[model samples]
Target: MNVSLLANSLVGSEIIKIGNEVNEMKRKGAQISNLTIGDFDPSIYPIPDELKEAIVTAYNEHQTNYPPADGVLALRETVSGVLKSRYALEYNANEILVSGGSRPLIYATYLALIDPGDKVVYPAPSWNNNHYCVLSSANGVAVETSVENNFMPTGDQLKPHLKGATLLALCSPLNPTGTMFSAEQLLEICDLVLAENKSRSADEKPLYIMYDQIYSLLTFGKEHVNPISLRPELRDYVIYIDGISKALAATGVRVGWAFGPEVIISKMKSLLGHIGAWAPKAEQVAVAKYFRDEAQVDTFLKEFKGAVQKSLDTLYNGFQEMKKEGFNVDAVVPMGAIYLTLKIDYIGKTTPAGDLLKNSADLNFYLIHEAQTALVPFSAFGNDESVAWFRASVGGCSLEDVYAMLPKIKTALSKLK
Candidate 1:
């Protein structure tokens, strides 16, 4: 049976495929330290007490009906207020659109702005920009990044591709790297985007930016920067994607938002409205109430950031120790997000059983067995499959879990000859 060409051509998530492999090992009673998925294990990191209680209360009050096409007005207003107070972003509620987590909002942004065959430029070793481009029939140009710049794409890397690109998909506290754009770094990119848009004719579609700042509040010491916040002039061309999934450790709650030019936002709301992807009404109501209490929000954030930081620090320090001990292992200083960029460059090395580690996927599987650990390789995020850099998500693990895996990693590396 033949299906639609788009359906047939769509590429599935490589991370999910690796996750399934980890699950199969776990089911067989393997003590696997699985760090493939970009989600929090609720047992390790639960949602805020105030927000959780509000969710229950809202349900009890029978707020389970269909939500407004755009979203409940109250939640939108709360989101606007939080952005204004925290980031100094002055978006009105009317410009905000709520959806189920950031995924739908991102997809809607692509569909709303990109026509078939348009170009979408994004940094590789980032998130799922490649798949989104495919879904929208846009030509995806992935700018490869290096560790010297903390795995972030620079203006020089992106300038050549900016000429005719319709969309520049960017994420800070970028998913796989756990690194963010410094103010000066992001300012340079913003300047480039501003110039590109300025060069476009009024009749032509201006180059737009889809800035994903979902992990903005999760930054350790570095400040999270956004395009509009850096260059207010680009506000009209920037669409922001953010939510509580990362900050609140509430991935399951499924409340996310996108705010930008009223024109693009209106079109996005229309697209998402037909798909009926509005966040659950009860969760939306609960989050709105949670946002209004500044003290409670700050307290929860303080505690939440501590837990996430502990795990990230454990991984970063552990890998550094290994690197100092002369192992072929290194990691980036985790600045933001729940990920640690791990470099285990063992390609062409021989494993204990004389099997050769040929690529990133091979290195991943070897660690799964030899060290009883699982990690998502950079190849999963649109990089070449042979790269050894991988993303270790700490959201699902505990401090003890990280420590226990350290010796296992050392022992496994020792076996490589």
Candidate 2:
């Protein structure tokens, strides 16, 4: 059967592919420590009691109708306050657009800004910007970042690509790597972007930034920085993606927002409205009321981040121990988010079963079968399969699970020669 080229050419998420394989093994009674998906195991990281109760109360009050096309107004208002209080961002409700989750907001950002063949530049191993570019029919540029920069793209690395680009997709406490940009690093990039915009003609679409800070609130000790915060003049050119999904362990609740210039935001709101991608009315109402209490939000973050950090630290230290023991493995210090950047450079080795580990994927699967451990290779995040670095997401795993998997991974690597 024939299909639209876009539909036929669309690639599925690699993380979901690996996660499905692990889940299937688990269903077959395999004892696998699944670390593939960037989602919380609600059993270990439950949503705040106050927020959950608010959700129930909203539902009981019959707030089940379809939400406003942009989002519930009250939720937008609350999100506005959050911006002012948390990040010193002063976007009003009119400038905010809410959707079911950050995914739609991100997609909407692409659709609103990118014309066909327009260039979209993002750092490789960052996240789904490549796929989004495909979906939007834009020319995608994946700037390869180095491990020396903790996999975060530096201004010098991204400067050359900014010319003639329509959008620059960026993230901090970045997905897949759990690394962040220092203020100086982001400041440099911000200056480059400002200069790029200045170089563009007025009729030309200025280079816009789709800044995905979904993991902003989950940072361990590092402060989350934004392009506008560093360069307020860039306010009109930056759209921020954030929500309660990571911060409140409420991924299932489906509430995310994008704030930017009113004109751009209005277009995105119209796009989402046509798609009918609003968050549930009840969840929006619940979040509006629940998030208004700054004290409660801070209290929950303190405990939630503590648990997430403990798991990240455990995995980082475990991999460092293996490196000290002469295993072909290493890990970056946990900076933020629930991921630990890992180096499992055993791609050319042979498994005990005589299978040649040809690439990161092969090495990952070998560990899944031989050591009952699972991780996402950088290939899944737009890197080549030969890249030995992998992302270990600890959101779904407990500290005990992380502790137990280390020795198994070491044993599995030891058997590979």
Candidate 3:
């Protein structure tokens, strides 16, 4: 039986593969500290009490029905107000499109803006931009970023690719790296975008930006920056993706929003409507009430940040201590998000059984089986196979779990001949 070409050609998620491996080990009673998935263990980090209650109330009131394709008018208005208050972004309610989660909004952005063969530029070792490009049949242009810039691409690196690209996908408080764009760095990129769009005539497809700021509120000691916020002139060409998934520890709530040009937003609404991807009406109603209370939002963020920061700090400090002890490990400072950019650079070393470790994937499996810890290597995020860097997400583990895992990691590394 022949499937659609896209279905046949699609590679399975590397993250899921690693997750399944972890699950199998755990099922066999191997106490593995699984850190591959970028999701919170709700038991360790639950959604806010107020928001949860509101959700229950909405459901009890029989708010379960098909929501408007663009989201309920009140929810869109709440999102608009939240943006205006926090980041000074001032899109109207109609300019915003609500969906099940950030994934659908991102997919809709790709579908709405990109025609087949259109070029989509994004930094490698980021998120799933490559897969999105394949789904949309767009030309994926991967910009190689380096650790010197916190693994973020600069304007100079992106300049050559921007000439004919349709979308420049970017994210701040970036996933995998747990790093963010400094205001100055992002402003420079915004300036480049402004210039590129200015050069295009009315008839040409203008260069647009898909700024995914889902992890913006998770930054630690760093301010989140966006293109339009820095260069207001570039406002017309930027689409912003955000939601409560990270900030409020509400991933399963299935509420996300994207705001951009009215034309693009309208098209995305129609597309999502046909796909039946709107956020549940009860969840939408709950969020609308929850978002309007500024004091509660502040309180939730303060407590949530404290918990997340502790987990990140523990993993980051553990790896740093291993480095100081002359182990073959290193880690970047955890600036934002619930991930620590870690390096288990033991490639080419021999295991105790005389098997030579081959690549980052090999190291990843060694950590899973030997150390009883799991992590997603940077190579999984569109990097070359040789990059030994990996992302150790802290959201799924406890501080006590981190304390127990470090010794195991050290012992495992010592056994590598």
Q: Per-prediction TM-score, please? A: 0.99, 0.99, 0.98
Cα lDDT tens digits for candidate 3, 262-358: 9999999998889999899999999999988988998988988898888889888888999999997888888888888988889899899888889
By TM-score, how accurate is candidate 3? 0.98
C-alpha displacement of 224 in model 2, angstroms? 0.9
Q: How well is each residue in 186-268 modelled by candidate 2, as lDDT tens digits?
A: 99999999999999999999999999999998888889999888999999899999988998999999999999999999999
In candidate 1, list every pair of residues with a backbone clash: none
Cα deviation at 261, candidate 2, in Å, is 0.4
Cα misplacement distance, residue 304 of candidate 1 (Å): 1.4
- Residue 235's lDDT within candidate 1 is 86
lDDT of 1 by residue, 119-238 (tens): 999999889999898899999999999999999989999999999899999999899999999988889999998999888899999999999999998989898888988899998899
Clashes of each: 0, 0, 0
| Winner of 1 and 2 under lDDT | 2
The TM-score that candidate 2 achieves is: 0.99
Stretches > 4 Å off in candidate 1: none
- Candidate ranking under lDDT, highest first, comes to 2, 1, 3
* Model 2 error, position 1 (Å): 4.4
